[model samples]
Target: LIKITYPGLLLEEILSTIAGNCLLCVTKLDFSAPKSLE
Candidate 1:
């Protein structure tokens, strides 16, 4: 059971990290780009 669970937990951790990085990148892009309406 431990062997099966370890990989799943690791995958979840990696996916979360990737998602967090993507969100951070998107936020940075939004901040760097100027809006025409502004």
Candidate 2:
């Protein structure tokens, strides 16, 4: 059970990190699109 638990925790951490990065990318894109028109 200990072996299984460690991998699960690591997977969750990696997924959360990726989700955070994706959110930042989206926010930056939204902020930039309007400026390009000018």
Candidate 3:
């Protein structure tokens, strides 16, 4: 069971990191290019 749980924890950690990066990118883009297409 340890082996099975280890991968699950690792996957969760990776997913959270990716989500955080995506949020940061979106926020940065919005701030940098607000109303540019207008």
Give a tens-digit lDDT track for model 1, residues 1-38.
86476998878888999999999999988977766336
Superior by lDDT: candidate 2 or candidate 3: 2
lDDT of 3: 0.87
* Candidate 3 residue lDDT tens string, 1-38: 86476998878888999999999999988987866765
lDDT (C-alpha) at residue 26 in model 2: 97
How are the candidates ranked when ordered by lDDT, highest leading?
A: 2, 3, 1
Instruction: Choose 1 or 2, whichever is better by lDDT.
Output: 2
TM-scores, all candidates, are: 0.73, 0.74, 0.71
Report the lDDT tens digits of candidate 2 across residue range 1-38.
Answer: 75476998878888999999999999999989988876
Ranking by TM-score: 2, 1, 3
lDDT score at residue 19, model 3, on the 0-100 scale? 100
Angstrom error at residue 8, model 1: 0.3
Q: So what's the TM-score on candidate 3?
A: 0.71
